[model samples]
Target: MAVWSLWSLLLWEALLPPEVTHAQVQGQVGGHALLVANRPSSFQVREAIWRSLWPAEELLATFFRGSLETLYHSRFLGRAQLHSNLSLELRPLEPGDSGNFSVLLVDTAGRAWTQTLQLKVYDAVPRPVVQVFIAVSGDAQAPKTCQVFLSCWAPNISDITYSWRREGTVDLGIEPSGLFTDGPALRVSLGPEDKSVAYSCIVSNPVSWDLATVTPWESCHREAGPGRASYKDVLLVVLPVLLLLILAGVSAWHLGPCSGKKKKDVCADEVAPEAENPLV
Candidate 1:
C-alpha cells in the first residue's frame, strides 16, 4: 500500500500545471507602478489527494525567487491560504523590476515542477503644448480686390506642415510668403461676398493635431434690432407652451389617489337619511 501511494504521488507531481506570475498596471501617477502575482492551477485535483500528498509550505516557497526590497508590497495578497493559490502584488513599480522570475512547485513525493515569467514596465508619452498668434500678410484694401493678407500660427513640430483653404471660390489672395512661422495663427481677408465666409487655421504635430476656425463675423455676432430676433421673442413664443404641455401630462399621470391602472372602478354608495325625522 505504501509503495503504491508513493508511486501515485510521484505521478501527480510530475503532471502539475506550470506556475505563472504577472504584473498588471492598475493605476499610476508620474511613473509606472504595477501589481505582481503567482497563481496555481489544480482545480481538477481530487480533495483526498490534496490532503494526503501535498508538500509543506516551505517546499512550495522554494519555487519562487525575487527581491521585493525596493518594490512597494501590496498587503492584500502577501499571505496566501494553504492548498489554495499564491500571489504577490507590488505598486510604484519601476523599470528595474523588469526581468524574468523563476518559481518552483513540489509534491509530497519530492517531485518538482518549474516555471519562469517575464515582466516589463514603461513610461507614457508626455502631453504636447500648443500656442496661437495672428499675422497680417497683405494690405487691407487693394484695387485688384484679390490682394488681402492674413496668416495663422500653431505649435511647431518637426516633419509636420500646414496649408490654407477658403470656403468660396472667391480668392482672398493668400500668398505663402514662401515663409513658415511656428505659431498657431491664421491671416487672410474676405471679399464683399465673403462677409459670411468661413476660414480655418490648422495645427499639427507628429503626436497630435488640432484646429481653430473663425466663422464670418456676422454669423458669430449680431448688431441687434431690425433683422435679429430678441431673447424675449424666443422665451415668450416657445417656453410657456412647452412648460404647460409637460405640466398637463405629469398631472394626468400621478396626481390622484386612483391614478394608476390597477385601481378599483366601482365606488360604495351611502344611503341618505333624508326626511327621516318628519316621516317617522
Candidate 2:
C-alpha cells in the first residue's frame, strides 16, 4: 500500500507541467520568503492571479493592474503580500504552506502567461557539531603522516549543505581533500613536522546557518610508551627466558636418571644423602 502511494506521487509529479517543478524555493518555518518574478515585457498586464496548485487547486490572491488594493484568499489573510511586479512574499511561513504555487498574468491584449514554482519549508538549521578522527596515511615522502577526518553535522535535519574552513598547521600538508568543497566531511594529511591544526565546519539550509570549530590532536601510538621497542626492553625480555631455560636444563639432568626403570632406586639413593643433611 505504501509503495502504491509513492508510485502515485511520482506519477503525479511527472505529469506536472515543467514550469511547475522547474525550480524550488526553501523557507524557514515561522520565517519569510520572497518569491520574485518580473513584470511581463510585451505590454501592460491588466491583472494577475496567484494560486496554489497542489492538494487541490485554489486561488491565493488577485491584483488588478494600477489598483491600490489586492484581494487575498481568506486563508492567506494577514499572511501574504503582493508586490507591483507580481512577486509574492509570504511571512511566518509554516510547514503546511509547503507546496506548488503559480501566478497567471493576463495582458490587456488578451494574451496570458504563467510562472510556477515549488516551496519546501523546513526548520531552521541548528548549531552544527564538529567531530574529528585520525589515522596513518603512510605517505612515502612524509612517513608517519596522519590523515585527519573531520565531520560536521546538525541533528534532526536533512537535505542541508556543509562547508569547511581551516586554520593553523602552516608547516606540513595544508591542502585538504575534495570533500572540503561541499561535502559534510573533509580529510587532511599532516606529518611529524606539522604542528597543531584547527578546523571549522559550517552547516546551512536555504534560510539559516550555524558553525562549529574543533582542534584535532596528532595521530599516534601514545599513552603507554614509544612506537618501537628499545634494545634494553628486548634484553629485559630475553634475559629472563634464557635464565629459565638454564634452570630447566639443570632440573632435567637431575631428573633424567629417574625416568628409566631403575630410576626410583637410583633417585632415592641420590636423595637420601641430601635428605639427611638439609640445605639450611
Best by lDDT: 2
For model 2, how does the per-residue alpha-carbon lDDT over 1-280 read when each residue is reduced to its tens digit? 4335334433433454322214578899998877765444664766666777885576666666455233544455688888877788889898788888877655666555567778889888889987777653433646555667887779999878998876652446666444255788887775555445667788887788888977654333331124655456688999999999999999999877677768878888988998899677
> Residue 86 deviation, candidate 2, in Å?
2.6
Candidate 1 lDDT, tens digit per residue, 180-237? 3344344444344555665555555333355545554343233222467656677797
TM-score of each: 0.26, 0.57
Looking at model 2, which ten-residue stretch has the lowest summed lDDT?
A: 217-226
Q: Runs in model 1 with CA error above 4 Å?
A: 1-40, 43-84, 108-113, 124-127, 132-280
Model 1 has an lDDT value of 0.39
